[model samples]
Target: MTMRAWVIKQYGKPEDLVLDRIPVPSLREGGAEPVDTLVKIEAVGLNFADEIAIAGRYQDRIEPPFVPGNEFAGTVVQTSGSSRFQIGDRVACQVRSGAFAEYCAVPSHRLMAIGDLPAPIAAALPVSYTTAHVALFQKANLTAGQTILIHAAAGGLGIAATQLARSAGARIIATAGSEDKRRIARENGAEHVIDYRQPDWHDEVKALAPQGVDIILDPVGGQTSERSLRLLGWRGQLLVCGFASGEIPALKANYMLVKSASVHGVYWSFDRNPEEIATIQQDLVGRCADGKISPLIQQVRPISELIEAIKDLGTRNTVGKVVLAW
Candidate 1:
């Protein structure tokens, strides 16, 4: 059978995405590992990573003529006999690619039962929230009463970090490029928000947190990453999440030496520490179900408008998560 999908014939920009019909994927194709569940995709959460993948700049690069989405929600229509999930179960899943299509073949291990959580919201949880939880607790070991500075505080990952930090009893200092975005940070439990676009934004952060923040979650790289090093307290940690700013910073080792601080690169991969990831996923899913934390969705558009939706994400014109309903 055929399915409609946005195919990238070549790596370029969002405008280069092409809507095309392709065969529905099976459990094993092109020698890929067998995926145990087949899902009729209901919603997809768009990330800046999608844009990065489209431009051929993402860390895990894929060749052309490939689907470009990674996180989604769907109902299971097919499953291997030994699969834990039965047909008709609703699930949230993450894949390396192929989420932009109407149907997706997911490895059962990457699938999480989402219960009654709305599709868009379920789709929004896996990537951003997982990254936030892992970075804050697993990597940084953020403690109660500690201070955290989250960059791009209005973006999906930023908002997730803010919410998680707040729940952990950490004081939050969020940074955004605009006033509206800054306000979003505050609404999502940030104790203070700074206009990161200003030249002396780090100074402002220092003023709010004289002892330096205990943790810095930096998704906006380049100068923002460099400046964040100076904002760390004694033994502070800077968690490098992504380079949304398009420029990777060359951090100075001297800053770490002076503050006795550490730098950690945070990236979520299914291949590493399966048990730990599953534990994190289960916790996050339960939190979402119980309303302990909410995924902030800025807009929900039809999948047909994927290009426009992704363009807004790329331009930094969006706040929180953007979902595409299929």
Candidate 2:
């Protein structure tokens, strides 16, 4: 059987993505490490990292002629003999690649039951929310009454962090480039929202926090990352999520020395601790089930429009998570 997929014949631009028919993956083909489940993908969430991977700039590089996607929602159509999931189970999965297809062979460990959540929303949850949960609680240990500054505050990861921080009883100061985006940040949970495009944005943050924030969630790098250091309170932590600004920033050790600040690089994919992953998964799933947290989907397009969808995301023309429904 064949499945339609977007394949990157070569690394370049979103325009370079090719829609092609490929044989559906099977669990039986797993040489040494067998895939546990075969998921018939229903929806796929688009991330900034998807574009990076397509352009050959991501940290984990894949050779040409590969699929470029990280997170998806689907139904289990097949499973290995020892798999925990049965056929017909609704699931959301996170993978390094192969999500931009009609069917994806996934390991049981990467699969989370979707329960009653919508497929697109469930697809959006695994990556952004998982990263936010780990970054805020595991790495930073954000506490109640603490203050956190979340940059790109209207995007997927930003909004996830905001909701999670609010649930933890932390005060949120969020930054986005425009008023509309800033409004989204406020709606999500931000106590204060600032336009980071302003030259004096850091000043605005300082004005809000006064003595500086307890934690800074920085996905927007470039000067934003460097300037965030000035807003860290004593023993404050700066969680380095990703460089969505396209320019990586250099931090000064002198600033860290004065504030006794710490910088933690948060790469959720590198987290191999099964117990920790299970804990975060359970917490996020429960929150979603209770309607305490919800993913904000900016747009949902057909899988055929993947290029246009990705282009909109790359240009920052959309907010929150973007999903391609198959």
Candidate 3:
């Protein structure tokens, strides 16, 4: 069977995401059953993880000439398994690879049933929403009515975290990059939005949370992370998610000691913490269905413009989730 997938001919730039036709993969000995599933790919969500794979940056290295996407939403047109799903089930799945395709096989276990939300929303949820869910609810143990701050507040995961935290009754203090991002952040439930590009954003945050935020969700690294501690409240928890800013930040040891603040790291690799993943998903999935956390999808560019979308995200221009359509 013919399978259409976005192939990275060589890891370098978004231009390298070339559309190509390849053979549909069949069941391997260890792979799950329902081998013949046909996913009419409706939407493919982009992640900073994919950008790293494309530019040869991600720590989880993959060989060239492979599918680059990690998540997608589609209707399962065919499946051999009858226990969990019927022929037509609209679902969003988390996978290590193979989502950027006209048809992809999702091991039933990795597939999570989506609600009546549109495919675009469902497609956007799997990665960002799940990651945000893990960061806020699982790792940080955020309580309702408390306050938290999110970096990259208008990006895919940022918006998800903002909405998720807001639904939990936490006052969201969002940090964005531009005016557009600022608007998106506020609309999504940020009690206050600070543009980090400003010279004294740290002061702005300090002014808002004189006592410091209870939780700090940081993906931007380098100096940004170092300065964030100044805004931490007593016993505040800093959740270190990534280095999207392209620099690793070093914190002053005194900051941790004096404030009784703690920092935690997150590496959403499949090798660790399977059960934690389930609980996070169940919570956010329910919230999404109830319209508690609405996704802010900025654009739905076709797979052909993969390069453009990647560049937009790299420059921090995309307002929210940018998806690739099959």
Candidate 4:
């Protein structure tokens, strides 16, 4: 059967995306044959990385005629060689590509069941929320009553980290670019929000947490990580999530020795240890199920507007997770 997809005809702008008919990707088990299990994508999540991909500036990643999405939520349409996902089971998955299409394939192992949450929320969780979960709880060893400073606190991972930190009983001090973003952070449980676009954003962060935060979750990188070290409490930790700011920062050794603070590099892509991810996923699922931690989705649009949505992400104009539905 034919499927509609947002094909990246060339890497440039939203206007460059070409919607076209494409073959539905086949499901494969053991790499042998097309299996019956089919994933009908219901929603796709957009991130700043998709924007970078569109402009041919996505870090070490190369250009695209490639589909730009990474995460999606879908329902099973068929099944073979996989009993775990029954027909019609609702699942969310992370993939290198293919989610922009009407249909995609998901190995039973990659599927995460989301009982009642909408596809938009499910699509938003796998990558961005997982990064936040990995950084705060797994990498930084977040514990109750700790104080944390989250850069880009209204962006995808930022909002996730804010919610996750608060759920873990960590006092949240967040940094955003504007008043609207600051309001979003506050609504998502950030105790303090600073306008990081200002030269004294870190100063404001320090003022709020005078003793300094125990952990700083920095994805902006470069100068962000460099300057954030100054606000670390005694024996605090800096969790390096990504270099979304386009600059990777190097640190002075003396800075580490002075505060006895440690820098942790958290690569969610590398945290592919399934057992560990399963455990954390379960933790997240339980909390989410109980409504203790919510999937705070802020924007939803159709896949037809996917390109425009991605461009909006590049402008950093979005708050919380931005998702596109079928």
Error of 1 at 154 (Å): 0.9
TM-score of 1: 0.97
**lDDT tens string, model 3, 120-180?**
8888887888888888877888898888999999888899889888878999888997788
Model 4: per-residue Cα lDDT over 136-245, one tens digit each? 87788899888999999888899889988887888888888889889989999998888888898887877788887899999889899999988898899999887878
lDDT of 2 by residue, 4-82 (tens): 9999999999999999999998786346555889999999999999999999999999999998899999899999886
lDDT of 1 by residue, 1-326 (tens): 99999999999999999999999988643334457789999999988889889999887999998999999998999887546789989999878999999999877877899988899999998899999999999999888999999999899999999999999999999888878898889998999988887898898998999989899999989988999999999999999999988899999999999999999999978787777888898889999898888989867899988999888888887999999998
- CA RMSD of all predictions: 1.6, 1.4, 2.1, 2.4
lDDT of 2: 0.90
Which residue pairs of candidate 3 clash? 145-169
Q: Which stretches in model 3 have alpha-carbon errors above 4 Å?
A: 28-38, 81-83, 269-271
**What's each prediction's clash count?**
0, 0, 1, 1
Mark the 10 consecutive residues where model 1 has the least summed lDDT. 27-36
What ranges in model 4 sit over 4 Å off? 9-14, 31-36, 55-64
State how far residue 100 of model 1 sits from its true place (Å): 0.1
**Would you estimate the TM-scores of all the predictions?**
0.97, 0.97, 0.93, 0.91
